[model samples]
Target: MSSSDIFIGETIGTAILILLGGGVCAAVTLKASKARGAGWLAIALGWGFAVMTAVYISAPLSGAHLNPAVTVGLAIKDGDWSNVPVYFAGEFLGAMIGAALVWVAYYGQFRAHLTDEDVVGDLSARAADTKAVEAREKGAGPVLGVFSTGPEIRNPAQNLATEIVGTFVLIIAVLTQGLNDAGNGLGVLGGLITALVVVSIGLSLGGPTGYAINPARDLGPRIVHALLPLPNKGGSDWTYAWVPVVGPLIGGALAAGVYNLAFA
Candidate 1:
């Protein structure tokens, strides 16, 4: 594939991936949405479907490496780093676009959810407590979860470890079983299988740190959340942002090492 094809395909595919993935979070979390309170199972299934759809849509052009971790792992596995920067650029740009679209699509819900009297009151109450204040400094705000992941408990070491392990599993699966015969994109069946693996990771390993196995997935939306003018939306929790980005890259590299040593 040409560089233009790689960039365009990845941009479109990653946008769609984040649009649907973040859409589910908005639907389940926002107060006025019909799917409010649908719970975690719904999110896992939604993301799985999102991955399947994005992979099939973009695989032909750019190999459907929507996640940065996937791109990094493939680069390491093939010992080719030529197209890595292009993929990263497309993934992050597409992710930001997708997140902005989600906000537009759910504008009314976001307004209602953020400006609700009860929610505002709760935030104010929490602000007064010293510990809660500290947590807010290092953790996400009320609506951040709709755009990005956060931890149930605020232990950096454990959170980092969880993200690393989750991403390791995802990249290893892609290296072993998710690639097409062309060795660039996912095959017809590989897309479905990869989607199932995503669901499995979400269900089994998503409890802590919300399983941010993709660096672009977390950071791009988080940046959007920080920039968008949502009323009463608190801090972006910049302090915790590094964990997701660094952990996934580490996990992808480690998975590539294992693949080279054992599978290659």
Candidate 2:
């Protein structure tokens, strides 16, 4: 496929991923219904499906680096600079469009079921009063956001440690199995490895805060959450937003640092 075709495929594939991934989050959270949260498994499985599908679709053409982190890691490891800019821009824009489509797909139901009060209640930030008023005009609420924070994390140090540990595991996995040495990987075997990691974290370490290991995955959706006006929207919860970004970034870097020290 041509570069143009690859770009188009990247955009479409990314959109479908977010549409399904974030859509499931909203299906239950935004509007109350019998099927609320029915899609938790769907959300998780859909993300894996999205990654696999996006790669399958774009691999022959452009290698399908659909994630910024993956792209960054690849550049760091292999020094492939030719298509970096194009792939980076494509992945970012694709995420935006993907999220926007999720916003559009669920627009009507938002208006029908949501009310002003519900939007007000969902704000993650304390400066919710002003934000809620703003969201009303835009027809949005708290946002298409996901965050991870340690429960009972009143002390800053322990919380930081938890984030570091989780991210360390994730980055190490990404490096060893994903971008570092693609040859010896478990191949299809790696898929279940990650699924197990997520489940284990959710069951054990995830109690305090959900695992917001990917910065783009959390903040990108949160930005959309703020902009896409829906009923009963809440605050952006800017306070805790950094946990995912900082934690994962640090974790990834630490994992890389450790890997280099041991193996390099």
Tens-digit lDDT string for candidate 1 (176-260): 9867877866888889999999999999999988888999999999999999999878778898899999999999999999999
Error at 232, model 2, angstroms? 4.0
Which parts of model 2 are misplaced by more than 4 Å?
1-13, 32-34, 39-46, 62-64, 79-87, 116-163, 178-204
Q: Candidate 2 at residue 207, lDDT?
A: 45
- Go through the candidates in order and give the clash count of each: 0, 20
Each prediction's RMSD over C-alphas, in Å, is 2.1, 5.4
Expressed as tens digits, the lDDT of each residue in 150-252 for candidate 2 is: 2355445666667667767765665576331342112344544544554455455654555555555566666766676654554556656667667666775
lDDT of each: 0.92, 0.55
